[model samples]
Target: MDGEPGRCGAGVQPRRLTSPGCGSGLDSLERRVRLPSRACGFLPMNYLPFRLLNDRDTFWGLLWSRRLSGSDLLRLMVFIMVACGVYGAIMAGWRSPRLSLYVAIKLPLLFLATTAFVSVFNWMLGLVFRTGLDFRTTIWMVFSAMTLASWILISLAPVSLLFMLSGVPALGTEAELQYAHNGILVTHILVLALSGVSALWVLREGLVRLAAPGCPVGLVLLTWIGMFAFVGCQMGWILRPFVGSPFYPVAFMRPDCLERNFYEFVFGEVMPYLLQGGR
Candidate 1:
């Protein structure tokens, strides 16, 4: 009798969770304990950025289901500016402190300006392609994709800085400087291409979801890319001096920036070779 199970605690009785929703208390407690015990030490709100990168399903789901408020947009814009700004500063560090500061300002401005100029067109194109994307949704989609790219660029800033310091000479002969500029330019192109590809991959599912039955998601994506690149390249040309060539002075914009567009410059340079080949 003394060794009886019920007698172990004497008068204390086992409590039964008979009330509805009572089990939730234990579940909540479990969650509270388990959440803090996570190795990342990330709180729910703080983990949203990571979720944006790795959890495409949830990220797009929230955007598609819920209307994002002004604060949401502002927060996203802030993140974009901060992330892009960091990479921009590092990108021109090899040049000088002034150029780094100039680039840090211009890079984010480039992104924001491009988005602002293209949003309406992008939305209309989405409609034509039957993607069911409204204006706000279209803007948010682009912003979100750009945010991904910004994150990627920021992540690679350290590597870029290393290459800038080691490979690109701050002071050298004209030939050496030209070679260094070419190498740095190519490096940035590759890094940007990778980031663009990754961002597009993240948006692939969302594009499909928005697209109507039988609509070609690939074509829609391509069209959007063309528009964005067309505008963005010209913007970059306008916001030149990001890399701060040793031959050129450190200015926010070149004096001849608006004299010609990027396409004109490209065409002028390539036509000479094309004509020579036909000759």
Candidate 2:
């Protein structure tokens, strides 16, 4: 009774500053109940890029975490894109030592155009479909999806670098290097496809996180995905020659973007097949 408040005799102790769980205050209680600081630090900001780059759960958590604002996600997304663009552009440049600068220019256009097109696409889709997501949030989701795609590409930088350094001799005849060059092009296309799929997967997960449980993907999402693929392919074709040319001795933008337009190429590749199949 000397300093204790309302002490119960013998078995029970007074609720005092030193008593366990007895009026210790919220701060102290929080410390006892809280997760370790390191574990909590993994949630949104600190090392999130690394986690999203590697951890599937962390990437999924990113979209759902209340702690992450749309703007916060966008900022991180842009940072990832910048890293992707730089990594890809530099590797392209480094691969084609003579025309490195030329190889570098197209990728930035590809990156910027892809991002811009996706944003506009989201806005237009939102207006038409009247989905739950607003224009800004729709845009942010697209940004996040592409960020995942970009992270995938970033992971492939080393593979691209390896390809850049290895292959048939640069001095060899075109016929001699044709298959090897085709292999390189095929590899790039595969990487691009995988990255696109990665983006789609991210989009699906994020939407699921936003949507009601057990619901199917709506028509709005389906349509958006179709347009996203078409836009991505056209953009890729427009900014061609990401991999340096092994055929042409040296020329910045060798065939050049305007000269290598996609429509004519696609029509040439697919129209004849369709016509023959029809016949």
Candidate 3:
């Protein structure tokens, strides 16, 4: 009731009435209107946000992630060296005409099998490191690393084979005959030493780029340790088996032996194909 002031009931102020849906009286109605308005429009889409990738971080991360321990690298190097020795044996054996046709066929097949085995081994290594390296990269890295090691072994193969072939006339001793074999062994050591130095250099450069000046001393120490362990273990493993099993008939039969032989053949025989200036 809009009763005028001073005119109603002892001059009391007039009462004013407001509309039900107007401002100051329709809080519930306003809320309902806003809610319905939002529903009629397009719903906000939920999107997964994309982060900008830093190129520098990506490159260095790929380079330095999952660094191999000194022991593991050493183990890998040794395995490669042994593989070279086995390869040399198979190549030498295959040259013999007296071996049966079946043996000849098996020799080539053995080489293929050895390759497959190494491929699998490298794949496993990638898995262990959780590296996203493709199979080709994995194989290439493995082969290149092993080739560096094989240089030493191949250089000494001639001497080792000569020693094995030449028996002492007076002593008639197979042990004495192995002295000639030491030449190939020495060559392998030398080549491995050279390769190790090169590998260490590459590793150092890579680490420096990765860690930057953040932890120079630690990186240097770690690299040094890895190089030493890798070289020493490789040399020791290859020589150890030979010493323990001299004149052992099964020495040439083992897959490990065949693998070593193939490595040597590739480095010694096929390496010429790879040289920029052919000899």
Candidate 4:
């Protein structure tokens, strides 16, 4: 009977998967094995402009949270560049057409080069302090500060333009126009100084968090701030006039840098208001 051609013998039987537990168990297994979507999207930043402008706590949190994702960093860097470019164009445009084009071309370069140099210096200081933050985070934090500066500069553009229009005399004799020129330049310098204060605050907060616990946070902060201002002022000077002199013929850039340092530029030239005080 067992060997009969059309008769079935005992054999392994396949189980049906039609039961509720069977299907549900497989789905449950998949749930256990697969990664959650939230796990995949760790701390993704959105609406950066809002966060950057109005949400300081969130901005600081994001910068320090982890290794920066390249996409986020790139977007932030672009915002910085565009803001700086806007400031450059607005500032130099008030002077002359040639100077505007020149500044527009140079501002982005100035941002990148200065950023890189400062970051390198920052990394060295990090090593001295034995700070644990990575180079990427440090750079990102610094750039975040610079972004604030650039935005402030952009906002001041209208104020600067207004001053240039009303304060700088168009057709006066050189001696007569000198006072107007001086006043406009002094006003712009003061506004830019305010912007520097905002940027320094951003940078200082990040640096404090990153510095080694035993490190003299004060010293480290001052050093970085001094270095940044020194390099930046010199770089600006080297890049030449953002506001060209009406006393001279229009040119895209100066033929050469002035034979003076930042201190000289401020005291000998910019802060002449101090020496002439109460006169």
Candidate 5:
């Protein structure tokens, strides 16, 4: 009786079906696919940096899909600056407060400047390699990976400081001070290398996602990484004094910073010494 087609009280004709499936299907899709959001398609800014570290898949998905807003990028950069500053201060703490302050400023500059300098080359390489990313996306990808490296450094700053304090005496004879300087320098090199490796691991999946149909992602990554490192090493050379030395004054930059780059130093000084077999 109630199932009759013309029954007067028959469920109000299902509310006239304003949208196909009554909008429920679309709502379910959004909930299943998107990152945690306060509003539809909008991630909360305060929680984004944590997501960048912990939810790489979702974060990269949003970035690659062009769904991320300017505010999201701004927040990411702010976190990078602060994280770099923290590690920089720790790196220079062995020298003096003044040197610490100087490095705190320089380290963030180093990362940003390196990214800015290599952006054009990076975008060109992406195009030549058919990576399916534009200039803006290419730069963002490189910078974000660099930021993760900085995050790793920040995470290890305390442990680094502990070792530096215990193993490298702040006040000592000339031989002792030289040993301390070299020790701290080598320690930083190792720590930085580790951070770089970790960042690369995290970015591997993202690289696959951004590559074009037939793109050789490994080759593209190699070229891009080589270029970035080539530029970054020279940038670090120019912005020297990161591992501060008591022998040198606490200046913002070395007086001869522009005289020669890292390559020249390696070829002229380091290579010669190695070739001579320490005499």
Candidate 6:
């Protein structure tokens, strides 16, 4: 009876009861349990502790990170050239000989100005996008988009003005002056609307980067003020020639023409210089 039922100890089962395979079913159940898979994969499988980057090192790193494609640079250059040509044609076309030469002389200045504006706008956008502090490529894109928009608006301004004037009341002296003034006002409003839209578009792209602390409010405000002042000064200069001249030809000059010039001064000179100085 001892050999058959309790070989090792009194009232104890055989050693086979406590062997490795005794809990095989329980081990299989435990092995089958697993964590659920993530759909988006936003969270890391393993996360390390956060560490702050060095200020100078981080800045340099960011500066080096921003890069542009050949096509982007080419587009930027073409846009600048086209914008300058359009502005020059608008400004000097009526004056005859001054047309070609003025455009030629002003081309360089226009190029410089447009380039600067694009650069700053791009930098602002980059900061907003939080693209790790790199700004070179961002600026290139901004400049390209703004320049292209400006070219399109300038090209369309004359056609739009002509359309507006076709409906004016042709009667009294007051009516004539009012009509002229309204034409100018409307053209200016259109140009500004286009420029504003372009700026907002550039800003939208940079907003992500700008979400961090220490936004460039001061720089942006200063840029705007500088642009306004430059426009005022240039307009004053242009108008000074005819300020008191009774012989000033209103017949040859459209009110919309003056207003458009004012905007050109703002976008073509003031904004660019402000950004250049800021840099």
85-194 per-residue lDDT for model 3 (tens digits): 45345323322322223233333333234444556554544444444445544443433334444444445556544543542222326665365234434543454467
Candidate 6 — which pairs collide? Answer: 128-206, 128-208, 128-209, 128-210, 129-206, 129-209, 130-209
Could you give candidate 6's per-residue lDDT for residues 1-279 as a string of tens digits? Answer: 211211112332211111113377335323322112332144321110000011111111122232235663554456556655564444333324344345434543544464464466545544654443345545543453455445555666476445434533334476564665465446544664575466444333333222233545445434533553454345434433211112243222334545556667668888999989955
Q: Which ten residues in a row have the lowest lDDT in candidate 3?
A: 45-54
lDDT score at residue 37, model 4, on the 0-100 scale: 29
User: What TM-score, computed on C-alpha atoms, does each candidate reach?
Assistant: 0.81, 0.68, 0.32, 0.72, 0.84, 0.40
Compose the digit string of candidate 4's lDDT tens values, residues 76-138.
Answer: 778777876776776666566667777776776676677787888887786787665568877
Comparing 1 with 4 on lDDT, the higher-scoring candidate is 1
Cand. 3 TM to true fold: 0.32
How high a TM-score does candidate 6 get? Answer: 0.40
Clashes of each: 0, 0, 17, 0, 0, 7
**Model 2 off-target regions past 4 Å?**
1-45, 54-74, 90-95, 98-105, 212-218, 249-256, 259-261, 273-279
Kindly list the per-residue Cα lDDT of model 1 for residues 99-155, writing each as its tens digit.
Answer: 999999998998899989888988888889887677877887788888888889989
Tell me the lDDT of model 1 at 265.
83
Residue 148 displacement (Å), model 2: 1.4
Candidate 6 regions exceeding 4 Å error are: 1-67, 87-131, 154-158, 161-182, 209-279
Off by over 4 Å in 1: 1-40, 43-47, 273-279
Among the numbered candidates, top lDDT falls to: 5
User: What TM-score does prediction 2 earn?
Assistant: 0.68
On TM-score, the stronger of 2 and 3 is 2
Better of 1 and 6 by TM-score: 1
lDDT of each: 0.73, 0.58, 0.37, 0.64, 0.74, 0.41
